[model samples]
Target chain A: MPKVTIDGHEIEVSQGTTIMQATKQLAIEVPYYCWHPGLSVAGNCRMCLVDVEGPPKPQIACYTQVTEGMVVHTQSEKAKKARKGTLEFLLSNHPLDCPVCDQAGECDLQNFYMDHGQYDSRFDEQKHKKKKAQPVGENVMLDQERCVLCSRCVRFCDEITGTGELGIVNRGSHEEITVFPGKEVNNAYSGNVVDICPVGALTDRDFRFKCRVWYLSSQDSVCPGCSQGCNIRIDSNLSRPQHGEGERVMRLKPRENLNVNDYWMCDEGRYNYNFIDRNRIQTASRVKEGVVEEILFEDAVDSLASVLGDAVREQRHGRIGVLVSTQLTNEDLFFVKKFFKTNLGMDAVESRFSFPEGSSDDFLIKADKSPNTAGAQALEVIASGTYQSGEDLIDKTIAGEFDVLISFGVDIDGLLGKEKLDAILEKVTLLAYVGSNHNETSKKAQLVIPSTVYAEKDGTFTNVHGRVQRIWPAFPPLGQARPEWQIICDLSEKTGFSVSADDAESIFSEITQTVSSFQGLSYEKLGKEGSLLSTVKETVEK
Target chain B: MEIPEELKKKWDEAVARYEEKRAALLPVLRLSQDHFGYISAEVEEAVAHYMGTTPVHIREVVTFYELFHTKPVGKNNIQFCHTLACNLNGCEPLIKQLKEKIGIKEGETSSDGKYSFSRAECLGACEMAPMMKINKDIYGPLDKDKLNEIIENL
Candidate 1:
């Protein structure tokens, strides 16, 4: 270990650790632009220049390794002057349009300028102008005039995704970042560039001009887009009701979790948040003679409970069937087993239902499109060796084997063709749907009980890796909708079945007690970064 | 356009001279520029292919150096030195006179495709102050009459 002194604080670090990494241990703020922990160091930005005791001039801390007994100063007079000069040169060509820039509130250039820069303008020459508002990819927009030539976006494309669609063309003051003549940055992880960009140079095309970032409130959550449960922060527009589509969620930003996404998330998960507010089933509804009528959620729950109670009491449990989805959390799935399988003795409960096939890559995207298939597998809801696919569940319903059928966020039309799904709906006497979105299955159900999306609930989703991560609620369940776990608990209460759990935490506590893979875990144990089920089992054995 | 196998063989030899493949970029670019007069976008793409790098990286190096031309520069390439030494020795008016005589601005080629003019950095001939390099030759201590005569001879 090499010992280095930074700003009067002595710390020992590994052999190859840089001054910037050492300063991070001492809680010293060394402003940087091009130095991303996830990407390779280019050392182009001079913002992290620090004054060393021996060196004649300030050295760039990003690539300068700390030698043994080296003394460094990040806030010395020389260091501050060097950073001011670097900032002045960086801002020489940057346009003064922060009022209209989408990244104004969260941009590093704006933040660093407030922290380190207050210098008067000495430049009398006209600023160099370049292209602005160029759509670089399917999801990213480019404003060349605002760029500081950091090459972080370029490095992100070249190193992280290994898709080198971006490059710095020209030289010196005339240099600009752009793509090839006809190519676009349409990679699977193209949206990550906007997050890594330190200035207003790159912006999200979907979120640009939607709402000011200052007005958006962020809550910690996990992306339910795919089985690779990327940690995310849900940014919602609670202040502005009249924003686009009346959507509460403004955007989804990837949170840094080294075990999972590592400060980068796929474009599919980053933009999959529109469904949180679009086409949502806000209130419970009942269909009669092909006419839909809005009814109270309690009435729908009571009616479902009575039918389930009748089937269990009359020894007709074989007539009751439940089709579940992997979109439901682990707690929700656990409650489904306790109520329908354990209490009602329904043998036909299946959660092997499939979602639409999504495109995937080796990096972050998973072909299994749902978030919690492993959760269902861990709970044995999709029991091993049965291999009963979602199609088999639909086939049983179509054959009139079950008089009552309930779906939990399973879009039957998406799984089967519309005509085949309609045939199944006609065969079942009481078709009930409990989901947030309005799909073909929700539309034709005799009784529809609304459920909350992953954003509007607090639960744990066991990702494909068997890692149970937590998701905190970003908003209250929209309108009269409730989380699926709470809905299941209500149905259990009305059907003369006693459930020991009331909320998501209690349901998860019950799961930890029952499931072998989750024996020694709790909500506090599975913090932001989740614990793998295999590791949890090992800990319990120890 | 595809790069020739002969040129690619030279590039392979150049890459073997350096420990890292990226260090051979300048030598490889020089080989392409020697075989093909100037580096077009297609030539840049082909060179990047031969170098096993991206075009933007090659483009950055190509545009940074004064020797590598991106476009064709006719029969006579005139490089007017415009550094501090040449400017202090009154080279600005002479550069203006030379551009006027050639019927072109800086970085512009002649309409007849016979001449090219570009303002260059210090050409290392400050002793012969107020100098301009034409093709393979350097002319210096230039006045209005001397610059016009050089252009006339070209």
Candidate 2:
């Protein structure tokens, strides 16, 4: 180990650690643009210049390694001058389009300029021009006039995904980032370039000019698009509903979690968050005779409990079928198991209702689209270990095996066409749906209850690798929607099997007690990056 | 684009001379420019494919140097030195004279495809200052009559 002092703070690091890494240990701020921890060092962006005791001039902190008894000063006058000069040259060609730029608030260039910039402009020359608003990929927009040529996006494509689609063409003042003449950057992780670009050069096409980032509030959550369980921060528009056409969620940014997705996520998960606010079932409703009447959530749950409680009390467990979707979180799944399987002893309870598999790669996207298949499997709710049992549930319902049926977040029409779903609706006397989004199943169910999506609830999800991670809500449930566990608890009390846990944390504690895989785990222990299941931990230790 | 057998042999020798394939990019580009009149986009793509790299990477190198022309050159390619040595030796007046006679400026070719004009950094002949190269021949230290006579015969 080598001991180095950075700005009067001393720390010991490994032999090959850089000065920037040492500054990070001491909580010293060294501004940078091209030095991403996940990407290789380009050393072109001179924003991280720092003064060393031995070097004649300021050295770049990102590439200069520390030695024994080395003294470095990140806030020295020489280092500050170097940084000011670098920023001045970088902004010499920058078109001051801050008022219309989408990355005005969260851009590092703007943030660093406010912290360490020399405000007065010495440049009176006309700024160089390049192409603007070029769609480089399906989800990424490129503005060449604002680029500082850090080469982070070019290096990201070259080293990370191994898809060398971007490069800096020409030289000097005429240089700009571009793909081939006719080709485009259409990789599986293309949206991440917009996240890694330090300036407004690359912006998300889906989120461009939708709403200003300062008006949006963010919360940590997990992406429910697949079993990969990539950690994310959900940004919602709470104050202004007129910005994104009355949409609540503004965007989803990938949170750094080394255990799961590191710092990158697939485009499939990044752009699939509109379902949280679009086409949602705003209020509970019941189908009376042939027309649907809007009702309160209390009336819908009470009427459902009366019919299901009667069926279970008459020893007609064989006639009641409960189909749960794997999209429910672990806390939600635990309550579902407690109310339906434990109290009623229903034999036809299934959670692995199948849907169409999505396109996957060896990187982040998973073939199983649901985020909590492993959670359902760990709780012993999904018996077959496969997500292809929706056909079986539909077949049983069509054959008149069950007089009552309830499902959560399952689209039966999408799984087996509208004809089979119509058949099940005709046979079952009472078809109830407890989900967030509106679909054919929600439209046809006799009783419909609105529930919160993953972004609007606090819970944990066990990923495909058996790591249980936590998710916090970005906002309250939309309109009159409630968390699924709260709905289940209300139904349990009305059905003569009342449970005690009220919040998501207490319900997860109950899960840790009952499920063998989730033993000795709590929300405090799960933290941001999750904890692997006990069974997985034992196997990994071996 | 099919590379000729002799050019492929030269490319193999160039790759073997360097430890890495990409280190041989300059020599390979030079060979392509000598065989083909100018390095077009097709030739750049062919050279990049032969070197196991990308066309954008090759395009960056092609645009950096003044000698590597990207478009087809004329029958006579004329280059006038424009660095400190030539500027001190009264090369600007001679260059201006040639530009008016050629009916084109720097970085432009003649309309009849008979002449092309450009400014070079240094030709490594500072002793023969105020020099200009035309079709692999160098002429310098001349008066206005000698310069006009040389172009008139061509």
Candidate 3:
């Protein structure tokens, strides 16, 4: 380990670590733009200039490697002057569009100007005008004038995704970042460039003009679109009712988790939160004699409990099939296994909701669309006996084997076409559907219970790699919807079993105690990056 | 999409001289430009394929260097020096006279497609202060009459 002193704070670091990284270990701020940890260091931006007690002038901390007993001064007078000169030169050609820029609140240019360079405007000449608001691709909007020539987005496209769609054209002040003529940056990870861009040069078209970032609050969560379980931060405005809309998630930004997604996620997962606010089942409903009616949550639970109790009393519990979705959280899956298998003595609790195979890349995108398929498999929620897979469950339902069925987050019409789903609906006497969205399954169910989405609950999702990560609630559940674990616990209480877990934490504690795979793991132990399951096998396939 | 046999042989020879194929991109680009007169998008793609890189990488290199032309030029390309030494020695007047005679500004070709004119940074010929290159031949150290004679000969 090489010891380096940054601003008089001594710390030992590895040999290859840069001074900028060592300063990070000391919690010292060294302003930088082009040096992203995920991308190769370009070191074009001289904002991180630091003073070193040597023969050379102030060196850029991002490019300078730490040596033994190296002394660095990040906030010295010489370094500050160098940073100030760099900022002045960068702003000489930059447009004064902060008022209209989408990256106003979080722009690095504005931040560094305020922190290091508060000098008066020395540039009285005309500012160079480059192209503005150019639609570079389907997801990205490029403003060439705002670019600081960082090359982070270019390196990302070339190095990370290997798409090689973007490049810096020309030279000097006339230079601009652009894609090849007739070629669009339409890669799967194209949206990540906007996230990595330090300035408003590359803004997300979906999030542009939506809301200023300071007006929105963020909560750490995991993406539910795929089994990669890429960690994310859900940005939402809970007090935006004054803007004529209720609380809603604005966007999903990738939260850095080196083990899972390394500061990047696919555009599919980034934009998948649009369904959270659209077509949601606001209230519980029930159907009687082919007429749908809105019912209270308590009455809906009571009716479902009574019907299940009657089925158990008639010794027809074996015919009662439960179709679970791999989309459900681990806590929800645990409760389902406990209540259905141990308490009700029902042998069939099937997770037969198969997601269509999505396009995957060598990067973070996974073919498995469900985020918790490993959780479902590790907990043994997929029924073992006759109905093994989702296709088998649908086939058995069409064969008139199951008289009653309870489904969670599984779209029946999507699984089987309208014809087969209609045929199965005619044979099933009691159908209970519990989900967050208002899909075809909920429309035809005799009892519909509204469930919370991934953004509205705190639970663990064991990713495809068997890593158990936690997702916190960004906002309250929409309308009368409740967490899936609470719904299961309430239904279990309504029956003969007395399940007393009230919150997600309590149910997770019970899971750690009872589930062998989840033993010795708690919510606190999961932390931000999450911990892998103890019994996770290395050869588990996605 | 087809390279001339001579240029292809030169490109392969240049590639063999370097251990890394990517190091041969500059010479391969120069060979393509020499054979085809200008490096089009298709030429860039061909060079990129030969170099085992992407077209954007080749484009970045081509656009960064003023010597490489991405667009079409006339039969005779004229590159005039615009650095401090040339500007101090009446290069501005020479450029104006050349533009008037050629009937085109910088970065544009003549209407008859006989000549293309561009003002480039120093071509390392500062000792011959007001110098310009006409298709690889440097002519300088004269007035408007000499420039007219050079253009008439071309």
State the DockQ of every prediction. 0.60, 0.64, 0.77
Summed over model 1, clashes come to: 0
lDDT of 1 at A77: 94
Better of 2 and 3 by DockQ: 3
Q: Write the per-residue lDDT of candidate 3 for residues B46-119, one digit (tens) a residue.
A: 78777887788889999988878888889999999989989899999989999998899999998788999999
DockQ of 1: 0.60
Using Cα atoms with residue i matched to residue i, what is each candidate's TM-score against the true structure?
A: 0.95, 0.96, 0.97
Error of 1 at A485 (Å): 1.0
- lDDT winner between candidates 2 and 3: 3
Candidate 2 structure, TM-score to reference? 0.96
Error of 1 at A308 (Å): 0.8
Give TM-scores of chain A for all candidates: 0.97, 0.97, 0.97
State in Å the error of residue A246, model 3: 4.4
**How close to the true structure is residue A51 of candidate 3, measured as C-alpha lDDT?**
98
Clashing pairs in 1: none
Winner by TM-score between candidate 3 and candidate 1: 3
* Per-residue lDDT of model 2, residues A145-188, tens digit only: 98989999888888878787788987788889988777788888
C-alpha displacement of A155 in model 3, angstroms?
0.8
In candidate 2, position A171 carries an lDDT of 76
